[model samples]
Target: MFPNNLAFISSNQLHLVQSSLLSMLKGALHYTIPLTIITFCIGLVLALATALARISGIKILEWIARIYVSAIRGTPLLVQLFIIFYGLPSVHITIGSFPAAIIGFSLNVGAYASEIIRAAILSIPKGQWEAAYSIGMNYSQALRRIVLPQAVRVSVPPLSNTFISLVKDTSLASLILVADLFRKAQEIASTTYQFMLLYVEAAFLYWVICLILSIIQQKLEGRFDKYISK
Candidate 1:
């Protein structure tokens, strides 16, 4: 009779873990995907512009871009998200949680990836620039045709690492009342008083997602290797 009772408890515990994982993963699929995708896309664009600005040889633009990069890198992302989501409302600049999360993450990514991009662009041989000029190509034409293509090949690995990190970071959105995987897990743990189990479940989902992203990153790097070796 005691053995039967122990077996029943073990089965229930397993059931709880399974259900919690499924619930959180469902939220990740519905909310996390969109947040990560939008943030990365916007961040990529902003990062590229910021990178170009830093290297464009214009004092004002370079100064502003430098300040932005410095500020974001110096601060933690949580404080940044808090400023956007909480502090802005005091100034009557109202925004929703999801959009605020997207903005915060984008700004962070912009600051970090800009450095990666700038370094990659600088890595191109100075002779490439001379060759472009010798061929009567303007800076814009050379950048669009030759420089950017090779720079992109060099930047792919680090940028892909950034994107994967963004996937896990999206969990922070839950703090701002966004219904992401971590938020769902928080709700479940609060009701059931199973914080450890539910959080572990959420972590499992994040791990699975990151694993997939890593595999995709490997494939992309392999593809880019062809261009890099030439």
Candidate 2:
């Protein structure tokens, strides 16, 4: 009976790990990918606007950009998430947890990305703007043709870092029943009552995903460097 008992325990552990991994992958598809794409797109737009505003001739626009970046960078992302998810409901304009999480992450990403964008834009020589004007090119035209392409290449490394951070940040969604990878692990752990083993497996999966992302980031940087170095 001793080998039979051991076999039962081993099979049960394997089942828990498999279920947890499957559920985590399933939840990641539904919650994580959509959240990352939505948040990153929204943030990219906001960052562009904020960066433009900061570089505008208007003082008020610059001040607004400054305040936005300051506030977002100064505050913790977790606190911002809680306020959007929990506190906002008190005002009667309730958002679902998923939407709230997206909004919070987008705002945070925008604030950080704005600085990178502005720096990238500024890195171009002032003579480029003068030359664009010499050819009768307006600000927008010059920016589109001459500035943004270069700035985008320069910003890729930072942007990759932001995306990687967003992937990890998705774990925070568990607090709101968003059923992300972490939440899947939690569910499996409760059902199997093998918290440590299941959680360790989940962590391993998370690490693997992050490692793949890191490899992609490195390749991107290498490509960008090849173009920029020339």
Candidate 3:
């Protein structure tokens, strides 16, 4: 028999337990969701810009992009997060932890996603760009209407994976007291003294989030498969 005080075992405790879970979910939605979406979108834009710069005829732009990607990809994300979160405030930037986390994650993702975008763009037959230009589509027009559509198909799967990783990475925000899911779990576990129960529940919640994201990723892949074969 379990300890009578163990919150996990009692029928009447179910509502209380669920309320805690609901609180965790709300925290996740509030803190983690914004971090994920903002980082991914910002990263995507940076990737597009970097990819274009890398391929552009300008040598200075190409070199700048190369340096940025190399620096970002070479550094540990933990260090980058620390720099953004703690290091900048020392220099008077004074960014909030949540926004700093977003910037760090976004820049990190941008470095990796830039390579994916560049590779995707390069994988397209040069003839596609040429064809678009032959039809009087300017560089921007061709890139927007012709090249990017195809590149997006190639980019979606990896980008989805990046977002999944980003979701998991949001746990790092707990270090800064952002009150995300894991932080809430830690709070509950610390107070309730049911470390194993709370931790297992937290782990299960993380797994469920990943599973849901995986399902959506698969659907997105299927949707984009209409454009790219492999």
Candidate 4:
């Protein structure tokens, strides 16, 4: 009876760990990747527009962009997530939790990335702008063709790092019921009474994903360097 009991306990523990791992991986696929990609893509667009406005000759547009960035960067993401997910619905403006996560994250990313982009654009010497204008290109044309390409190269590393950060940050979505990897781990741990084991395993999975992303980031940076060298 004692041997049988020991075997049963070991098997249950193993099964619990295995299930936690599997569910976390599944959640990563279903929620984490999609959230990161969608938020980053939308945020990049918003950032680009905001950055341009910041640098544009128009004072009003610059002021508005500044306000947006200030507001976003000044607040906690957790609070922003709460307001978007819970607060807005009180005013009869409804948004689903998944979309609320996306919008909240996108706004956060946009504010930070806009400054990165603006700095990258500013890093290009003023001579480049003059040279383009001298070649009969308007401000818009020069920006579209010449300035942006150089700026993109400068911005790539930081933006990629931000993207990796965004992946980890998406774990916060669990607070709003997004059912991401961390959330899945929470669900498993709650049921199995194995919080430490499951939580550590989930963290290990996050580290693995980040590690893979870091490798890819290095590769991308190297590729960019190669192009610049050529």
Candidate 5:
């Protein structure tokens, strides 16, 4: 039989866990989720533009896109975030923590996702473009009407993966003083000295969020597959 005091300790621990979970969830709802959605939407636009530029055959655009992608891919995301949040203040370009996180994550996603988008665009047969031209479609028209639709189907899986990754990466924003999910956990743990429990709780929340996203990704893939098959 357990000691009577053991029950009281267990109850206290349970209360702590529940309260910590609530605080972390609030942080996630307020910052982590919103940041992910906003950054990813902006990143997708940047990715599409960069991908288009790379394939545009304009030397200047290609060079600019290439350098941007190279620079982003070569650096660590944490370093990028640091540069935006910490390093920039020295140059008199001080951005707030949330905005800095958004810019850093968006730029990182844009660079990596551009490559995925570019490959998807390239995977479409030359005949598709030729067929679009034969049907009186200009380059822009073909891209808008024929090519991009097909490329989107190809890119969905990888892009979904990228979004999932960005969800995890948002934890890094804690370092920049964004009160995201992990940051909330850190705050609670520091007070309670329950570092392991709080950190695991945070990880579990992340896993749950990612699991839901994975399900959504699968559904999206299935929907796109049906369109492709038809």
Candidate 6:
């Protein structure tokens, strides 16, 4: 009788795990993945603009970019999220949870990735710029046609790492009721009182997603390597 009861309990637990997995996956698919993609794309644009501004030889633009990067790097991401999601309403500017999360994440990414991009652009030799100029290329034309393309190859690996980190960072959205993967896990755990199991499962899902991203990153790096001189 005890063995039969054990089997019954095991079956119920398995069913619970399956249901929880499905629910969390739905959250990931519907929210987490989309959020990462959207925020990263927006962030890349911001990063490029900020990096260009810093290197543009204009004192005002450089100062603005410097201050922006410094502010973001000095603060914790959690604080940034709270300020956007919770504090914004005090100024009568209310943002919904998902959009707020996106704004916070994109700005954070922009600040950090701008440094990476700026470094990559600088790493290109001065001769490359001179060569472009010799070919009658203006500064903008040289950057667009020559410098930025090479910088992209150097920047890919670090940018991929940033993207992977962003995937995990999306869990922060749960704090603001974004109903992402971690939020789904919290919901399930609260009802079943299975916090350990649910949290582990949620972490496993995040690991899988990051693992896949790492593989893609490797593939991208390999593709970019073809252009590199031996």
lDDT for model 4 comes to 0.94
TM-scores, all candidates, are: 0.94, 0.90, 0.88, 0.94, 0.95, 0.94
Best-fitting candidate, measured by lDDT?
Answer: 5
Per-residue lDDT tens digits for candidate 1, residues 142-211, read 9988899989989999999999999999888998999999999999889888787788888988899899
Off by over 4 Å in 2: 1-9
Global lDDT of each candidate: 0.91, 0.87, 0.86, 0.94, 0.96, 0.95
Instruction: Please write out the lDDT profile of model 5 over residues 1-230, one tens digit for every residue.
Output: 87886545466677988988889999999999999999999999999999999999999999999999999999999999999999999999999999999999999999999999999999999999999999999999999999999999899999999999999999999999999999999999999898877899999999999999999999999998888799
lDDT of 3 by residue, 35-151 (tens): 888989998999999999999989999999999999999988888888887888888887888888888888988899999999999999989999999999999999999998888
Task: Rank candidates by lDDT, best first.
Answer: 5, 6, 4, 1, 2, 3
In candidate 6, position 1 carries an lDDT of: 47
Candidate 3 clash pair list: none
Error of 1 at 186 (Å): 0.6
lDDT of 1 at 12: 61
- The true-versus-predicted C-alpha distance at residue 192 of model 5, in Å, is 1.1
Model 5 misplaced stretches (Cα beyond 4 Å): 1-9
Error of 5 at 156 (Å): 0.3
Task: Write down the TM-score for model 3.
Answer: 0.88
Candidate that beats the other on lDDT, 1 or 4, i.e. the better one: 4
Model 4: residue 69 alpha-carbon error in angstroms: 0.5
- Collision count of model 3: 0
Across residues 1-230, which tens digit of lDDT does each residue of candidate 2 receive?
56875556577687767766778888778888678879988999999999999999899999999999999999988888888888888987788889988999999999999999999999988888889999999999999998889899989988988888888887887887688788888887887788888778877877888799899999989998898889
Residue 71 shift from truth in candidate 4, angstroms: 0.6
List where candidate 6 sits over 4 angstroms from the true fold.
1-9
Return the lDDT, model 2, position 29: 84
